[model samples]
Target chain A: MPTSRMLRRATPWLMLAPSLLVLVPFFVLPIAIMFRNSLARDNPATGMLMPEITVANYARILGDWFYAQIFLNSLAASFGVALLTLLIGYPFAYYLARWAGRRWLPVLMWVVYMPILVSVITRVFGWIVITADSGILNGLLLGAGILREPVRILFDISGMTIGMVHRYLPLMILPLANSIAKIDPRVLAASTSLGASGRDTFLRVVLPLSLPGVVAGFQLVTAVVLSDYVLPTLMGSTRFRILAPAVFDEAIGSVRWALAASLAMVMLAIVAVTMVALNLAMRRLAPWARGL
Target chain B: MAVGEAGLDLEIAGISKRFGSVRALQDCSLTVRRGEHMALLGPSGCGKSTLLNIIAGLDDPDAGELRIRGAPVADVPPNRRNIGVVFQSYALFPHLTLRENVAYGLKVRREPPRVAEERATEMIALLKLDGLEHRYPNELSGGQQQRAAIARALAIRPVIVLLDEALSALDKNLREEMQIELSLLLRRLGVTTILVTHDQREAFTIGDRIALMHAGRIVQVGTTEEVYGHPASSFVLDFLGSASALPGRVEPGSPPIASTAFGLGFELTAAHRAGLAGPVRLYLRAEDVTLSREPTAVHRASPARVELSTFLGALKRQVIELGGHQVLVDAAAGHHGPRFAQGDAVYLSFRPESCFVLPEGE
Candidate 1:
C-alpha cells in the first residue's frame, strides 16, 4: 500500500491516541488493578494482600441473600430516580426549549445548573435537613396542622431518590432541552396547521424526537445513582442498604480490602450489564437516531 | 356565475396583528368565496404570511373577526378550525412513514381506523405517491416529501387550505412542475384556498385572484389580470412586475390626454381618468415598450441608447437611457429587427393603452 494511503487510514487512530493516553492510566489501569485485587485473598493478621488467588469473595456474595438484596436495592433506587427525574424534567425541558427564548434562557439554565454545581455531599446533607422528621418540611406541615406528626422521609430509599434526582436533574433537563431546541419550528407550525392540538403534536412529534436525549439522560443519571456513595451514606439509613455504601463500609470502616474490592467488582459488573440492556432498549426506542 | 352562491365561505373582517412594535397586519379584510383560489402576494415581512396564519387560526389577530361559512371562529382553536396548511419546509414527520403521516390528522380527530386508512390511501393515490407510502421522510427525495406533505394536508377534507410558500423550497424546474400539478389539483378539488407567496410568477401561476400587500396593508385585491394590467397603485405595479415609471400629467377632455416626461402624449379613456387630476405616474411593463430602427407614427418614438442588454434565453431585457431617464424594455431574442448592442442609439415605442397611471400620493 502507498505511504499516503496508510497515513490517511491511521489519522483517526492518531487523533484518538491523546484520549486513550488519559483513559488508560487514570481509568483502565485502576479498574484492572481493582479487579485483580478482588480475586486475591487478603492476609487476616498482616493486613496485606496475599499471593493466593481465590473466588471465596464471589462465592460468599452469591451464597448470601444480604449481598443479593443490596444489588437489587441499588438497581431499584437508580431506576426509580431515573423515572421520577424524567417525569419532572420533561415539562421543564419543553418550557426551556419551546417557550423561553433568549430572554429567560440563561437565567433558567443557571437555575438548572445550580444544584449540580454544589458538591454531592452538600446536596445530600441539604436533603437530610429538608426531609428529616424534625426538619423544616415536617415543621411546616406540623405548623399548618396538615400532618398529625412528622412523616418518615430522611434515611430511607425515598430520601436517597430525592437526593439523586436533585444532584442529577440538570443532566436530564439539559440533554432533553438541547434535543427539543434543535427541532425545526416549522415542524411545530405544520402540526398545528394540520389540525393537531398542542397535546397531540407534543406526544406524537416532540416526545418521539426527544427520546434519544431521554435515553442519554437516563443512562447518565442511572449510572451515577448506581455507583453513588455520599448520597446513600447520608440520605439513606441501614434499613435501605445499597451496594455502594456496603463497599465503602467494608473498605474504610472495617479495613476489609478484599471484600471492598469484590463488592466494587460486583458493582462494575452490574453497571456494565445495565448499560448494555439500556443501549439495546434505546436502539429499539429511537431507531431514527441510529445509535445517537 | 356569482361566487359563493352556496353561501359566503371564509370572511376575515378588519384583521389587525402587531409583533412588539412592528404592525404585521393592519385592518386587513379579505373574503374568499367557496372554491376560489386567492394569492396573498408580497415581499418578505409584508404581512402576507401574517394574514394566512391568522386565517388558519395559527395566530390571533389583535383586532378583527374571522368567520368560516358565516360562523365566527375567534374562539375556535387551530385544530378545531379544520384548516389545512402546507408549509415551506413541508415539515413531514421524520419517524412516521408517508402513509402514517398522511393519516395523522384523521387519527388525531378520532376518525375510524378503516375510514382514515381509506382516505389516506385515496389521498396518497391522488398525489401519485403509491409505492413510496411505506418510506420515511428521510428516505424520500425533496419532491416526494413535498407531495407527501400535500397529501397529509388535504387528507382531512379541510374547510380551507393554506399554502405558505409551499413550492419555494423546491428547485426551479421542480417548482414549476409542482406548480402546474398543484394548480390542476386545486382546480379539480375546487376547495377554497389562500396561498402566500413573494414570487410574482408563482402568484400569477396559481392564484385566481391576487391580493398585493405592502407594509401591513392590502394595497390592491383583484383578479390576476386586473392587478397585473391595471394596478391600483405604483407600489402594486412595482411589486407585480418590472415597470418603469413615467412622470406625467392628465389633460382634461372628453377623452383625456396624458402628457408624459418622454415628450409623448397618450389618449386615456374617461373611466381611466375618473378620480385622477394633475400629476400622475404612468407604469409601463417591460414587454410593452418596443424598440424601432425608424420612428413610428402610431406612438411618438423617443431616442435612447442601450446601457445594458441581458440575454435571458428567448427574452432579451435591455436597459435603455432615454435622455436623462432610464427605462427597462424586453425584446424577443429572435426578433426580425437588427439586434441592438451596448451604446447603440435606438427609438423606443409603446402604445398609450399599455400604460397604467397612478395619481400622485397613491
Candidate 2:
C-alpha cells in the first residue's frame, strides 16, 4: 500500500524517471563515452588498452601546426560562409516577410524552401555546372566579353563556401523572417513619430531589434557549416581540411575511434561555448525581444 | 505664448480613408488648442484610431490636411511628424529598459547620450519611474508600463501627445488611477494632448473638450458640459449620459411646452428651446425627477403614483408613474420620504432646465 506522503513525493520522480532513463543512454552516454575515450591512450606493446587518461588528444591537436591549420581553416570557411549568408539572406527574408503577397506566400515559400528536399549532392551538382569554366555562368560572362578565360570556380575554398551557404541559407532565413515578422507595424510608426527618418527607424529600431534573429542565424549557420561534410567533400580538395572531416577520417577510415571520439568531444565543447557567446550577444542587442 | 515649442494647435481638415467599399473616415475634421487635453470618444470601428494615426502621420489621409500650429504637414512622414503616440497596448520596446525606451526619441533627435540620459531621467522622475528604470516592459505591471509609455512619449516633448486607448489594458481600479494621474500630468506639462477611448468616464475625466464620433463621422464636439448637458443632437444626448427617451409633442403656446404621457407637462427652458416643435423626442435624465409626498399643486409638480423604489448604497432610485408613463428618480440613501410603497400616489417634479430637446429632422 502506498502511503499518501510517499505517493505525493514519489509520483513526480516516477513520472520523470522514464524520460531521464531514455535520454541518458541515447544522448548523454555517447557524449560521456566520447569524452572519456578522448583522454584514453593504449600502450602498443602490451596490446591492451590503458584506461590511463592523458591530455594527449587535446595537446596533439593543439601542438601540431598541421592540425592547428585545419582548425583555423574550418573557422575561416564557416565564418566566411555564415557572414555571406547573413548579408544576403537577411534582406531577402525581410522583404518576403514584410512585403510579400497574401496569396503568393506559399509559392514564395516553395521557391525558397524546395531546395531543402533535394539531395546535397544534386544541389552541389547544379552549382558545379553553373560555376564551371565551360558551364552557364562562365559561358554567360564569356559571351558578354567579361572574362577572357573561365575562372577557377571549383575544388577550392570559394566553391565550398558557396556550397555551404546554399545549404545553410534556409536555416538563417527562417529564424530571421520570424523575428522581422513579429515587429508591430506600430513600432515603426512610433519610431518615425519620434523624429526618426525612414532610414533612421530601420537602422535604429528594426535592425537593432532584429539582432536576436541575426545572432541565432549566425550561430546556426556556423554550427551547420562546422558539422557539414558533403559540401566540402564534393566542392573542396584535400589541401584545405576542416575539423569535422579530419576527425571523421581518423575515426572511421583510419579506424582510430579513440582519436575521433576525442575530436568529437572537442567539437561539441566548441559548439556549446560558441553558442553561449552568441546567446549573450543576442541578449545584449535585442533585450526587448525576449519579452515578446 | 499660447503655443509651446511644437505649438499645440492641431488642425485635421477633411481627412479621409477608405478600404475597398468601406469608408473608415470621410472628411473628418478636428482642432485642439494649445495645452488643452481633448478626447476623441467613440464606439469601436468609428475611425477614432484612424484619425489618431493620421495625426501621427502613420497613415496619410487620402483627402485631408494635417497641420500642427499653422504648418501644413502634407509630406511629413510619421517619424518626421515629431508627435508622440502612446498606443492602447503600450507598444513599449520589450527588449529595452524603461529608460532606454524613454530615450529612444531623444536619441533619434541626435541628442548627445548625456543629454538624452538627463532628459530620460527627468521624464522617469516625472512619471515616478524611480528605481524601475531598469525594468523591461514585461517586468512591470500594466499601470507601470503605461507610465513608462507616458514617460517615453513625453520625453520627446513633441507638440501633440496622442494617446490611443492607453489605459484600456489596465484593470478597472488601476485604469482610473492612471487616468487621474495622466490628466494631472498633461495639465502640469501644458502639452496639447488627444486621447482616444471607448470608456466614457476616461473621456469625461481627461478631456476639457470632447468629440463623440460614430460611424466614421464626428457626431458632436464641444465642451464636456456642452456635449453632456446640452447635447446638440439626440445621438449626443443618448450617447454620453444615460437618457430616458419618451415620445412627446409640444402643446400650442407662445412659450412652447411638451405634453407627454410620461409626465403631465414639461415647459421648454431657455436652454432647451432648440426642439420647440410639433413632434419630437424628449430626453430626461433619470436623476432630474424629484419625488414628493402625496399630491401637491406646486411649481412644475404633477401628481403621480409610485411603482417601485430601490436602495443603491448612498442613493435610492425610485420609479414613479406620471400620466401612465414611468419616470425614474434618484435621491439620498435611506429616504423613506412620501412613505412610498408600491401603488402609492405621489407628486413628481422636474426643473424645466433639466430636460433637453433635439430638433425633429434629426
Candidate 3:
C-alpha cells in the first residue's frame, strides 16, 4: 500500500517526464546556451565567438541609435497589432458568446480559425495576392469611388499589419469569447432592471468582467507579434527593419552569433516585462478576474 | 380610467406572447394596488414568469398595455421603467463588492457620490449586510448573496419591485427565514411588490393576494384564504396542496346532493356545489378529513378500512378505503384518540362546507 501510494503520486510526474525530457534538452538547454553565448565576445579577425563574460553586445545594441530604433519600432508595431486585433475581434467575440445560436456556434468558430489551418507561408502568399497594388481590395475601393486611384499597400507596414491581423485574430477572439460566455445573461438583465442603460451596462459591467480575457488575448498577440518573423519578412520591404529580422541577419546573414543571441535576449526581456506588466495591470484594474 | 384605477400602482392589460407556435402568455391581465404584495403562484411554465418579464419590461408582449404609476410605458425601455428586479439566480455582479453592487444603479443615474454611498450604506444595513459590504458575491454564502441582491435592488427605491423566484435557491430553513424577513421588509418599505414563485407555501407566506396561474392564464386571483378555500377549478384545488378527489355527480335539490359512482352520497350546500349540476369531482383537503375509531354524530361518517397509516411527526396521515376509493385523512398525532393501524377499521368524516365540488374534466 505504501509503495502503491507513492506510485500514485509519482504517476503524474512520470507521465510528464516525456515532455520534460524533450523540453529541457531541446528548449531550455538551447536558451541557456544562448544566454551564455550572448555574454560572450566575437573574435575580430577569426570571425568566431570567444568564451568571455562581457556586456559589450548588450551595450552596443543599447548605445547605437539604429539598433535602438529597431527595438522601439518593433515594440510600437507589436502594440499596434495587439490593439487592432482586439478592436476588430471584440464585437465578433461578443456576438459568438452572446448571440450566436448553439447549432451554428461550432461552425462559426471553425470559420474564425480557418485561416490558421492553412500554412502560414501559404497564407502570407495569399495576403500578397490580395494586397497587391491592383488587388481585389483596391479594385473594390476604386469601383466604389472610395479611392480616386489605387493606393500603395504592398511592401508597406499596412500590408504587414493586414497579414498579421488576419493571422492572429482568432487568438484574440477565442479568449474574449470564452470570458464573455462565462458571464451570466441574467446579470445583464439585472443591470437593465436596475435602471442602467444598455451602454452603461456594457461599459460598467460587461467590459470590466471580460478584462481577464482581454488581458490574455492582448498578452498573447503582443508576445507573438513582437517576435514574429515570417509575416514582416514576406510582407515588408527590405528597408523596413525590426528586431526579429535584425536577429536573423546577425545569426545567419553575417554569422554574428553573439549579436544574434543578445538581440534575442533583449526581445525575450521585452516579452517577459510586457507580460508581467499586463498581468499586474489586470490584477489592479479587475481584481475580481483573478483566479477566474 | 375605471373607478379603482386611480389607486393602482401597476396594471397589465390583455398581455399575450407567443414563441413560435407555443403561447407563453395569453390575454393575461392583472392590477396591483399601491403598497400591495402580490404573489404570482403557479406550477412551472404556467406563464407567471412571462408575465413578470413583461411587467419588468424585460420582454415585450404581443398585445398588451402596461401602465406603471398611471403612465403608459409601452415605448419605454427597461432602464427607464424604474423597476427593480431580483432574478432567480440573484445575478449580483460577481466583479463588484456588495457595496458597489448596491450603488450601481445610483451610479448609473449619476447621483452624487455622497448620496449614493449614504443610500447604499442604509440598504446594506437594512438587509443586515453591514459588515460584509467589502466582500464580492462569490465570497458570500447563498443567504448572504441573496440579501445582497435584495439590498442592491432596493437601493434604487424604484416604483415597484419584482422578485422572480428569488428565494428558490435557498435551503428550506434559510428560505423560510428570508421569506419572513423579505415580506416584513417590503411591508415596511410599502413598495408595490410582485413575487413570482411555484411554491404554494411561499406564495401564502409572502403574498397578501395570490394570483394563481394555469396554462398561460390567471385562473384565480384572491386572498390566500379565498384562493385556498374556494379554488375556481379542479386545477387550482390540485395545485395548491395535496387533496383527495372523488368522482361523482351532482343531484339537484334545495341543497344539492353529491352522489359518488359507488352509491355513496353526501349532502352539499348550494355554495359548495358552485353550480356544477352533472358529473363532478369533489376535492377535500387532507387535513379537513378526519378519522375516528368509533362513529360520531357531529358529521356524516362513513365506515372505511385503513390501508396505510404514516406517523409524520405532528400529524398522523392515513389512507382509507371508502366506497372502493382511497381518501387521505390527517389527524393530530399523540392526542387522546385511538390510533389506527394499517388494516384497522375506522370512520371518516369531513365538513361539507370545506369540500369543493368542481365540474369534471376541468
Candidate 4:
C-alpha cells in the first residue's frame, strides 16, 4: 500500500487515540483490578485481603440472605423512586413545554432547577427538618387538627424515597420537557381539528412520542438512586441495609475489602443489566430515536 | 336569520380576533352553502389564516358567532366541532404507520376497532393510497404523504374540511397535479370545504368562490371570474394579477370620457361613470393589449417603444414604454409581426371596453 493511503487509514484511529488513552487507564484498568481484587481471600482473624484466586467473596454474598436482601431492597427503592419521580415530573414537564406562556416559563424553570443547584447534603438536611417529629409538617397537621399526634417520617423508607425524588426530579423533567417541546404545536392542532379531544390527543400522539425521553430519564434516575451512598446513610433507618451502605460497612468497619469489592461488582452488574434492558425497551417502544 | 336552510353548511358572522394589540381579524363574515368550496385568498400576514383557524375552532375569536350546519358553535372546543383539517406540512403523526394515522380520528371517537379499521381501509382506497398503508410517514413520498393527510382528515366523515395551504409544500408541477386531483376528490365527496391560500392561481383552481382578504378584513368574495375580471378595489385588481394602471381625468358627459396626462383617452362604461367626478385610474390586463410595428389608423393606437421582451413559453411578454408610462403586453410567440428588439418602436392598442376604471383616490 502507498504511504499516503496508509497514513489516511491511520488518521481516524489516531484521532480516537486520546479518548482511548483516558478510557483504558481510568475505566478499563480500574474495573479489571477490582474484578481481580474481588477474587482474593481475606484472613479469617484480621479480615485483611490476602493473595489468592477464589470465589469465596461471591459465595459469601450470594449464600448470605442478609446481603441478598440488601441488594433487592436497594433495587426496589431505586425502582420505586424512579416511578414516583416520573409521575410527579411528567405533568410539570408538560405544562412547561406546552401551556406555560413566555412570561412565566423562565420563572417556572428556575423553580424546577433550583433544588439541583443546592448541595445534596443540604437538601437532605432540609428534608430532615421538614419531616422531623417537631417539624413544620407535623406542626401543620397538629395545628389543623388533622392528626392526633405527630407522624413518623424521618429515618424511614418514606423519608429516603422523598429525598431521592426531590434530588432526581429535575433529571426526569428536563429530558421529558425537551422531548415534549420537539413535538410541533401544529400536530396538536391537527389532532384537535380532526375531532380528537385534548385527552385523546395526548394519549394517542403526545405520550407515544415522548416515551423515548421517559425511558432515558427512568434509566438515569434509577442508576443514580441505586448506587447512592450519602442519601441512604442520612435518611434511612439503621435497620435498613441497602447495598451501598453495606458495602461501606464491610470495607471500613469490618475491614473486609474482598467482600466490599464483590458487593461493588454486584452493584455494577445490576446497573449494567438495567441500562441494557432499558435501552432495549426504549428502542422497542420509541424506535424514532433509533440511532441514539 | 335564515341559517336553518338545508343548503347552508357554515355561516360566520361578525368574527373578530386580536393578538395582543394587533387586530388579526375584524368582522370577517362569510357563508358557505353545502358542498361549496370557499377559498380565503390573501398575501402572507393578511389574517386569512387567522380567520381559518377561528372557523376550525383551533383559535377563539374575541367577538363573533360561528355556525356549523344550523347551530352556533363558538363556545365549542375544536375536537367537538366536527371539522377536519389538512395542514400545509401535512402534520402526519410521525410515529404511526399510514393506516394508523388515517384511523386515528376514528379511534379517538371510540369507534369499534373493526369499524375504525374498515373506515381507514376505505379512505386509503379512496385516496388511491393502496399498497402503502403500513409505511411510516417518513417512508412515503411527498405526494403520498399529502394523500395520507387527506385520507386521515376524511376518515371521520367531518361535516366540513379545511385545507390550510395544504398543497403549498409540493414542487410546482406536483402542486398543480395535486390541486386538480384534490378538486376532483372534493367534488366527488360533496363536502363543504374552505381552502386558505396565498396563491391566486391556486385559489382559482380550487375555490368555487374566492374571498380576497387584506389587512384582517375580507375585501371581496365572488366567483373567480367575478373577482378576477371585475375586481372591487385597486388592492383586489393589483393582488389578483399583473395589470398596468393609467391615472387620468374623467370629463363628465352622457357617457364620461377619461384622458391620461400622456394624451391617451377612452370612453368609460356606464356603471363606472355614475356619480363619479375628477381623476380616475384605468387598468388594462397585459394579455388584453396588442402591440404592432405600424400604427393602425382604424384603432385608437398609441406610440410605444419595446423596452424588453421575455419569452414566457408560448407567449412573449413585451414591455412597452408608452409616453414615459410602462405597460406589459403579452404577444403570441408565433405572431407574424416583425421581431422586436430592445429599443424597437411600436404601437399599442386594445379594445376600449376591456379597460377597467376605478376612482383616482383608490
Candidate 5:
C-alpha cells in the first residue's frame, strides 16, 4: 500500500520525464551554451571563439547605430505584423466561432489552417510569384487601368509584411477563435437582452471576454514575427536589415559566432520583454482575463 | 402599428421555428398579462428555451409575430426590444464586478452615471447583494451569482424579464431558496416575467400560470392549481407529478363504471367520463390513493398486496399490487396510521372525483 501510494505520487513525474529529458538537453542546454558564447570574445584574426567572459559583444551591438536601427526596425515590423494580423484575423475568428453553422465550421477551420499545412518556404515562394512586379496581381492592376505602371512589391517591406502576415495569420486566428468560442452564446444574448446594442455588446461583452485570446494571439504572432527568418530573408531586399536576418548573416555568412549568439540573445530578450509587458498590460487593462 | 391586447405585456402568436429538419417550435402561442409571472415548463429539448429566445429577440421565429406592450416587435432586435434575460448559466459578465454588471444595461442606454450607480446600488441591496458589489461573477457563490443576474436584469426596468432555466443551475436547497426569493422580488417589482424551467415544482413554486410544453407544442396552459388539479391530457398528468396509470374500459351508466382487465370495477364521476366511452386510462396521484386495513364508506375500496413501502420523511409511500397492476399510494407518516410492509394485504381506497380519466394513447 505504501509503495502504491508512492507510485501514485511519482506517476506525474514519470509521465513528464520524456518531455523533460528532451527539453533539458535540446532546449535549455543550448540556451546555456549560447549565453556563454554571447559573453565570450571572438578572435577576428583567426575567426575563432576565445574563452574570455566579457560584455563587449553585447556592448558593441547596443552601442552601434546600425545594430540599433535593425533592432528598432525588427520591433516595429513585428508590432505592425501583430496589429495587421489581429485586424484581419479577429473578424474571421469571430465568424468562425460564433456564426458558422455546424456543417460549415470544420470546413472553414480547415481553410484557415490550410496555409499552415503547406511548407512556409513554399508559401513564401507562392507569395513571391503573386507579388512580383509583372506577376498576376500587378498585371491585373495594369490591365484594369488601376495603375499605369507595376508597383514595387517583391524585395520590399510591404512584400515581407504580407508574407509574414499570411504565415502567422492562422496562429492569431486559432487562439482568438478558441477564446471566442469559449464565450457562452447565452452571455451575448444576455447582453443584448439587457439593452446593449449590437456594437455595444461586442465592445462591452464579447471583446472584453475574448481578451485572453487576443493577448495570447498577439504574443504568439509578435514572438514568431520577431524571430522569423524565412520570410524576411527571401522577400525583403539586402538593404532591408532586421534582427533575424542580421543574426543569420553574422552566424552563417560572416562566421561571427559570438556576435551572432549575442544578437540571438537580444532577440530572445525582446521576445521575453514583449511577452511580460503584454501580460502585465493585459492584467492591468482586463483583470478578468486572469480568472478566465 | 397594431396595438397590443389590453393588460398584456407580451404576446407571442403563431411562432414556429425549425432547425434543419427538426422542428424546435410549432406554432407556439402564449400571452402574458402585465405584471404576470408565467412559467414555461417542459422536459429538455421541448423548445422552451427556444421560445424564450424568440421572446427575448435573441432568435427569430420562422413565422410569427411578437408584441411588447402594444408594439409589434417582429422587426425589433434583441437590444432594442427592451427585454431583460437571465440565462440558465446566470451569464454574468466575468470581467465586471456585481455593481458594474448590474449597471451595464443602464450605461448602454446612456443613463447618467450617477443615476446608473444609484439604480445598481438599489438593485444590489434589493437582491441582498450589498456587500458583494466589488466581487466579479466567478468569485460569488451560485446563489449570489443568480441574485446578481436577477439584479442586472431588473436594473434596466425592461417591460418584460425572461429567465431561461435560470434557477436550474443551483443545487436543490439553493434552488428552492432562490425560487422563493426571486418570485418575491419579481412580484414586488411588478415586472412581467417568463420563467422557463423543466422542474415542475419550480413551476408550481414561482409561476402564477404554467404553460406545459411537449415535443415543440404547448399542450396546456393554466394557473398552477388549474393545470395541476385538472391536467388536460395523459402527458400532462404524467409530466406534472408521479401518478399511477391504469388501463381500463368505461361502460355507460348513470355514473360510468370503469373496469380494468382483471375485473376490478369502480365508478368514475360523470364530469371525468364526459365525451369518453370504451377504453380509457385512469391516472391516480399517489396522495389521492389511500391504503387502509379495511374498507370504509364514502370511498370505493379494492384489495391489493403491498409491493414496497418507502419512508419519504413527511410521507409514507407504498407501491401496491392491485389486479395485476402496480399503484402508488402516499399516506401521511404520522403515529395514527397503520404502517404496511411488503406483501401485506391492504385495501386501496379513493374517491371517484379524484381520478383523472383520459382516452387511451392520448
Candidate 6:
C-alpha cells in the first residue's frame, strides 16, 4: 500500500512538473488572477477590488435562452465541420494509400498533406477567396448555369466548414491514409484472383483494414473542430458559441474566468467519453484487424 | 473438379521484360507440358524468378505472349488468368485465419458458404493442417504458414500452380520435407506446378522435369536422370561438377577407350557408336565409380595415387590427381592394396559401365 501510494504520488505530479514549469505561473496564474478579478464586482462604495465574491457575472450569461442558443448552435456548427472534413478526406486518403503507384507515392502524398505547413489564418483567407459570393467556385458554377445568382457562400456555416476542412483535412487524411496503406495488397489480389470483381475487393479488403484509421481520424478531427477557436469565429456569426469560442468569450473576450473554466471542463468530459467509447468499440474489432 | 481441367500446357513465347535499362529477361521461351512438375533453377539475378512471375501473370512480358492451353492472354488481366501462385514469402493474408486464407478463393468463386467451408476443411485436412485452422499466419511457424499458402492455392483448383522459390524460406530440413510433400501433393492434385529455386538439389529433388536457367535463358530442360546423367553442355557439366572429368582422345580399340594423363585410358563397351573415335571428355560420377584391392568381377583395378582423400559417410571419395585438377573416385574404407599413401603410386580402375564418355565438353 505504501509502495502503491509512493508510485501514485510520484507519478502524476512528476509528469505535471515539466508542464507546470510553464503552466503554473504563465497559464495558471493569469487564469487564477482572472477568476479573482471576475469575482470582484465594481461597486460605487469602493475604489479598489471588491472584498465580496459574487455569482452575478455567471447569472448574466445564463439568464437568457439567446445566450444558451448560441452555445447549442456553435456545437452543431463545429460538429458539422468535423463530420464534413471526415467525408471529403476519407476517399482522398484512400487514394493516397492505394491508387498512388509506389514510384510516385512519396511526392504525391506530400500534395495531400502540403496544406499543413502553412498558417491556419492563411488557409482561412484562401477559403475566403475560394468560396466568395462571386469567386472561383461560384464563377464556375454560374458559368455552368447551376445557379442564376452568384450565391453568397461566405460568413456562413458552409463557408466556415470549407475553411475548417481545408485546415483540419490533414488530421483526418493522415490517419485514414496510414490505415489504407497498411492493408495487404495481396489480400485484394487474392480476392480478385479467386473471381471477385473490382467492387468486391474494396468491400472485403480495402474497407475493413481502414476502419481503425477512420475512427482515430474521426476522434481527432472532431476534437479538433470542437476545440478550434479561430476559424469558426473569424468566418461565422459571433453568437455561435462553440466550446472553444465560448471559452475564448469568457476567458479573453469578456474576461469571465469561472464560465471559461466550466466550459473547458465540459469539453474535456465530452472528449474523454468519446475516446473511451471508441476504444471499447475498437477492442471488439481488434480480433478483426489481425493485430495491425 | 474434373481431371481434364487439372493440367496446363503453357507455351511462353518470346517473353522479355526490362526495367529502366536493366533487362530482367530477354526473349525467353519455354514449353511446359501438361501435368509436368518443372523447376526453374538458377542463381539470384539469373531471372529464374522473373520467368516464374511472367508465367503466373504477376509480371507482364514486354515482348511475348503467354499462352495457357494454347490460348494467348492478350486481353486477360492477372485476376482473370486463373493461375495460383505461391510467392517466395508465401504472401498469406496475415489478417485472415489459416482456414479463412484457404477458403478465400472458394468464397470469391461464389461457392456457397457451406460448400466453401467444407472444401476448405477438406483441403486443410488433405494437407494435414486440420488442427490449426483458426490460427492466423503470424501465430503459426514458417512451415505451417507455407502449408497454408499451398492449401490456399489448391483451394482455387487452378489450372497452373506456380511456386517462386517457395521452399527457400524454410530451413534445410524443413525444405527437404516440404519438397517431397509438395511434389507428391501436386501430383495427386495434378496441378501442373512450376517451382523456381536457386538450389540444384531442391530442383532435382522436387521437379519431374528440371530446367537449368543461366542468364535469363533455359540452358537445359529435362528429367532429373537425363539432366544429371547426360548433361547437354559443358555449362551443365560444370553445374553438375560434383565429381571429376577425365578428358581424353578416342583411338583404335575393340572396345572404345579414351586416354587421360600419362596414357591413362577408360574403356567403354556400352551401346555407343562403334566408329566414334576422337578427343572426348568422360564424366565420372563420384558415387558411380569405385576402388578395389584387386580386380573384381564388375570392376577393374588400375593404378592411382591418393592425392587427397576425404571421408564422407559410408565411403572415402578421394581426389586422385590423374594430373591436373584431380578426378574423384569413391573407395571403400579398410581396403587392401597398401591403402595408397599420399603421392604413392598404385593402380586405379573402375567399371566399364560407370565410365561415361561425353561429346568432348561433358
- Over B134-203, each residue of candidate 2 has an lDDT whose tens digit, in order, gives 9888899888888998899999898899999999999988889988989998999999999999889999
Alpha carbon deviation, residue A18, candidate 1 (Å): 4.3
* Ten contiguous residues minimizing lDDT sum, candidate 4 chain B: B294-303
Best by TM-score: 5
Whose DockQ is higher: candidate 3's or candidate 5's? 3
Lowest lDDT sum, 10 consecutive residues, model 3 chain A, at A283-292
Instruction: Compare the candidates by lDDT and give the number of the best one.
Output: 5
Cand. 4 Cα-lDDT: 0.88
Candidate 5 chain B, run of 10 with poorest lDDT:
B295-304
Per prediction, fnat is 0.68, 0.76, 0.89, 0.76, 0.92, 0.40
DockQ, all models:
0.62, 0.53, 0.80, 0.64, 0.78, 0.34
Global fold similarity of model 4 (TM-score): 0.93
What digit string (tens of lDDT, one per residue) describes model 6 on residues A1-292? 9999999989988998898899899987875676665565544333244546876655654676755675566557656766786789888888888887887778867877688888888888887788888788999999999999988677777677778888888888899999888877766665666656777777766776687897788788777777787887777655455667777776666654555555565565667776788778876765656455
- Best-to-worst order by DockQ is 3, 5, 4, 1, 2, 6
lDDT rank order: 5, 3, 4, 1, 2, 6
Classified by CAPRI criteria, candidate 3 counts as: medium
Worst 10 residues of 6 chain B by lDDT: B1-10
Docking class of 5: medium
Using DockQ, give the best candidate's number: 3
- Cα lDDT tens digits for candidate 4, B61-99: 999888999888977899998899999999999888899
Q: Report every candidate's CA lDDT.
A: 0.86, 0.81, 0.89, 0.88, 0.89, 0.74
Report how far off residue A136 is in candidate 1 (Å): 2.1
RMSD of each: 3.1, 4.1, 2.5, 2.8, 2.2, 6.5
Off by over 4 Å in 4: A1-24, A44-48, A142-149, A288-292, B1-3, B270-276, B296-302, B323-325, B334-336
lDDT of 5 by residue, B91-193 (tens): 9998899899999999999999999999999999999998899998988999999999999998999899988989988999899988888888888889999
Give interface RMSD, per candidate: 1.9, 1.8, 1.0, 1.6, 1.1, 2.3
TM-score of chain A of 5: 0.97
